[model samples]
Every structure is written in C-alpha cells, then in structure tokens.
Target: MQTIGKIASVGAVAVAAAFSLTACGGDDTAAQPAAAPPAPSSSAAQAAQPEGRECTADDVKTTGNFGQAPTITIPDDCDPPKKLITKDLVAGTGSGAKAGQQLSMNYTLVTWSDKQKLDSSFDRGEPFSLHLGAGEVIPGWDQGLVGIKQGGRRLLIIPPDLGYGQGGNGIKANETLVFVTDAVAVPTDKS
Candidate 1:
C-alpha cells in the first residue's frame, strides 16, 4: 500500500496548480488482470429511488459513485462536489493500458474529504506520462482512464474500492480519492 508521504508514485513529485479538468480512457489487449469497473453513466448512475439525495442530470452525469462509498457523499449543503476516480471515460477491450500509447497530463490529486493535495507531477512543469488504464498505478487510474480525447480535462472522485480500498498505504485509508487531470495526447494507433 502507498502512504501519503511515502512517494506513492512519480506523482509523488506532483504538486498543485489545481484549477480545472483533464480526462482519460482505455484500449485493447490488456496485459494484466482487470479490476472492477466504475459506475454507469448518465441518469443510470444516480437514481431518485430512495428519494433523498435529489440528483439533477448534471449530478447524475458524474462518474463517481458517491452513494456506494461511505467515505464520499453528496452534501445537501454545497453545490455537488466533484466526483473522483469513478469514470469509465472510454470502453475497454481488455484489462490494461495499450503498450505504446503515451499520456501527457497535468493533474492535482487530493483527498475527497478535506481536499488536501497528495501528489502532483504538474508542479514539475513538464506533464507526466503513464500507460492508460494500466495497473502501474492505483485502481482509480486504471478504472477512470478511458473514453478521453487528447487535450481534455475531467475531474475524478476515486472511491477506496477503486483506490487503496480498506487498507490504504498511509494517509488514505477507507478514504475517497480525487483527481483533476488534463489529457494531452494519445496515439491514434499503437499498432
């Protein structure tokens, strides 16, 4: 498990400039065992069935499963907060990232609850690269990184299930993950 101060990743060097969105997605011929998928999109994700947290189309459009993760919630107090790593931005034909695609991104990764920034490669000036949807990262990256176009930005609220889960590395245990990323580029074809 990765700890808060443990340099979980290159994003360990990642720092703030927290301003807006950046998106991600997936592809074919995955190289490893797959993880669980995020929630469905559109109105399907949020239902008024329980009749409590009233969801507008905008709220329903988010990728995070706020209802599923106890650590996350849609507060009746403020504007619905941004969802974390909970989007299947693109469809996957396999279980991991494509072998040759490179992702250039700027991001701010923080805790969903208190909004404390944890990692940020963006602070380094040059954006970072990662194989999309690959297990070289936490589950949130693996699951939420799909369906994104190049040069796009999107917010993600990563639930523990898609993150560190029950046993977190150090600072984030039983916690929700939050990320706002900017997808710079994706090769048109790896083959």
Candidate 2:
C-alpha cells in the first residue's frame, strides 16, 4: 500500500484478503487511543497508532465468523464521538437484524488483511442491531460503540485478539480488522 502521509493504501493481496485500513482523518481523531499497539488492541481511544499484522485478502473465515469488521479512515483532524447512535432499534430492521432492544445500524465490512469489501447493508439500505456492551457483536464494536450519539457514522479496527484470533474466520484470521458503519438508531426495551 502506498502511504498517503500516515495512512497507506495497502497492496492488492492485502486488499484481496481481509484488510485493516486505518486513517488519521476527520473529527474522529479524538476517538483514537494513545498507545496504539501492533495487533494488540489497546483501550478504546481516538487516533490509533497502529501496529501488528495487517489483514490480507486471505484472512476471512466463515465457520467462526462472528461479525463483519470494517476499516475506518479519519481525517487528519477528527473529533471523538464522530457520530453517536441514539435511536430506538427494532427487530429485522433489515436482514440479520434483531429488533426493539439494541441499536440498529447499516454498514459495510472489509477484511483488514486484504482490504476486500465484505458486506454493505447501507448499499442494501438495511440496519443491524446491538445491545451496546452486551457482547452481541465483537469486543471492539461492543466497546468502541458506546457514548456515541444516535444516527452516527463510525469506523472501527478490531484485532484478531479482540476478534476471531489465529484460527481465522475462513478468510480472516491472525489479523486485525476494519469496519465502517452507520448507526441508524439505539434499541428500545424488547419487553
């Protein structure tokens, strides 16, 4: 990948595989952490100093498939809480979505290992849900998603440690991940 100042474009194989793309952009900068390690996901913070194995196109696995993690690119000047999610979620807001209890989102996912475009509910115009810190999704999403206002846009990078570690997710394994998401709404009580 070619370096655009700090963010690199990554290579084809990397793009072909599940690639993790990080950027120093927008107001999302404050959302990054201080001690960004290589592969070892540090505490949830804005402006991550990334390190570790980059996701290639061959990292994504299906069996252990947990969640689709997409890469986020923040402008050189990003502000935390880039966009928070706060609406009430409903079940089946879209395919693979549970309703009325957690936040719902429409998103696009790519493999950090290869930078491949994996999933995109936004193009499909759908939204998924989350219980917010409920362990429904990956650890990164569970944690990085808090304190965000309703109807927001977020980019996340989850390491294999915080993700599906080593064994790999059919195609994605042994690598950190990246995700781009649109928070449609917060979830309401199921009962």
Q: Which is the leading candidate under lDDT?
A: 1
Off by over 4 Å in 2: 1-101, 167-170, 187-191
46-89 per-residue lDDT for model 2 (tens digits): 33434444333223222111133334332223222212222222
1-191 per-residue lDDT for model 1 (tens digits):
11221322422222211111112212221122124334546553353124444233234232332111112124332332223434433332322334435566555566544445655545544455666643445546645666555645555665555555433223333555666555656556544
lDDT of 2 at 117: 62
After superposition, the stretches of candidate 1 with alpha carbons farther than 4 Å from their true spots are 1-100, 167-170
How much lDDT does candidate 1 score? 0.42
- Write down the TM-score of every candidate: 0.50, 0.45
Tell me, by TM-score, which candidate is best: 1
**Per-residue error (Å), model 1, residue 68:** 31
Candidate 2's TM-score reads 0.45
